[model samples]
Target: MTDSVGFDFARLSPRDRYKLLIGTVVPRPIAWVTTVDPEGRPNAAPYSFFNCLSADPAIVALGIEFRPDGAPKDTGRNIRASGCFTVNIVSDALVEAMNVCAVPFPPEVDELERAGLALVPGVAVASPRIAAAPAALECRLHSFLEIGNSREIVLGEVVHAHLRADAVDDRLHVDPAVLDAVGRMGGHGYARTRDRFDLPTMSLAEFTARTDASDA
Candidate 1:
């Protein structure tokens, strides 16, 4: 005998549905973003619900949420003011600094300075990228998507990219091992890309040939 269990989200509350979503998502990539305020102070934050939205347009997205009183976060405000931002890929080596950048400091405070992170000037934008980040994408705001009361999605077009010289090839193939990227898990947890393997697909003719050779 066996038993099965399922939860009907339609009947459940929104908060419950959110819990299920985040719990089941397991690991999500973190985008360590940097933007400059109107006064030119740098702001940084880590967002897990972020990913590339389009390749042709070279767009990336970050899902941001407002505070309880519906105030926009520093990231959103900075992006609106400057129209540009830099996204640095989080790595295991930079996790501690990345967490420090996540602190909700006052608008006048520069999070990068607070976190003791060094910065390099972005090629296509005024925003600076984390000096130790394995890779950085410089972007300009393309559009904004309002999902609900608290959630706002910002889509940005990639204007420039910088990768550690040894991590990429002449053809721009990035070596996963060199990146050492880390991902966010549910509730103060993270995962590393250290455990990975690649499997190549075989053609039908190759499979048939192998089968014939085995019988012989």
Candidate 2:
């Protein structure tokens, strides 16, 4: 590699390491997660450090951060209390509401109500799902990885899912264009999923043939 910046993560400050990670990760899928407290009050929050980890059991992971006061955030606390939550896919139209959920509101405040998003009863989980969300995955807490003081990695098994009517076909194939999802970029930035291209996996023979042809 040519001249590239390097860092010793062990020596770097946590904040600096975080900055680099978020900056280089480019666009990350936003998981607009919802969970319910003991009183059944729903809590909503957006976490970019989230993705599907397994397909066989349908597992999704969310990197939930703790508050600066060393206490778990509302969503984290609610998930631990309820053992279930909903992961709502954030579409372009719901970006504003998603941002509203990210606000550090008090635990007593209902983010769904404050954001003016409709919440529907979750079929498989106690947590509610955002009705406006293009797709919502009802997840049961499979496991929790307590890595450090900063964040907790939650691995959830998707028990059920809800998708927009026009976004999916009978064959269960989802149309990305119809979903119109958005991703979180570094520091107050976001990216659209519209501009996309497809590239098929190539066989070794095909790859060799292409390389020979190019050499010729």
Candidate 3:
């Protein structure tokens, strides 16, 4: 027997559908994105709807939402205008600063400065990155996707990356404990990535052998 209910997305309101998606998506990666306004003023913002879309081309995607008036947010508008952005990893230590950047500020205000964060110039892009971030990816606009009047998806090809020397190794493996990155949850919630366990994938022979052994 099962106890399950279904809410058809087609019949639900956008707000309700969004609530369901965010609530059920578990923890989502946070993109501490940095961009420059048309006049070259730096801007920093955080988005939970972001992830690495492809590794072959090293591409990342950011799903940016518009304002209540249907105006593009600073990050999306800046990316559309400049064709470049930087994504900084939000570690536990940087969570407060990342949240400060999320506040709605005027176009002239520099969110990075307000958060009192240090910055470093991007190696391959005009946008800068947070100096204290565990990792940062400099990206150029690859494409844009307009799902509706409410959201815009920005696909960017990562041209360069900077990793903390103490966190990443020459073999390119990252120590999760050292990185201590944070993630976003539904509504005003966040989660830490420190708690993790590994379960290796088994081959078919190994699976069959384990199953047979268990049956005995």
True-structure RMSD, every candidate:
2.8, 1.0, 0.9
Least well predicted 10-residue stretch by lDDT in candidate 1: 17-26
lDDT of 3: 0.94
Cα TM-score per model: 0.89, 0.97, 0.98
Candidate 3's C-alpha runs over 4 A off are none
Candidate 3 structure quality by residue, lDDT tens digits, 34-151: 9998898899999999999899989999999999999999999999899999999999999999999999999888788899998898889999999999999999999999899989
lDDT of every model, 2 decimals:
0.90, 0.93, 0.94
Cα lDDT for residue 103, model 1? 84
Per-residue error (Å), model 3, residue 143: 0.4
Point out where model 1 deviates above 4 Å: 1-4, 201-216
lDDT of 1 by residue, 57-84 (tens): 8999999888778999999989988999
RMSD after Cα superposition, model 3: 0.9
**Which residue pairs in candidate 3 have backbone atoms (N, alpha carbon, C) closer than 3 angstroms, thus clashing?**
none
Candidate 2 wrong stretches, greater than 4 Å: none
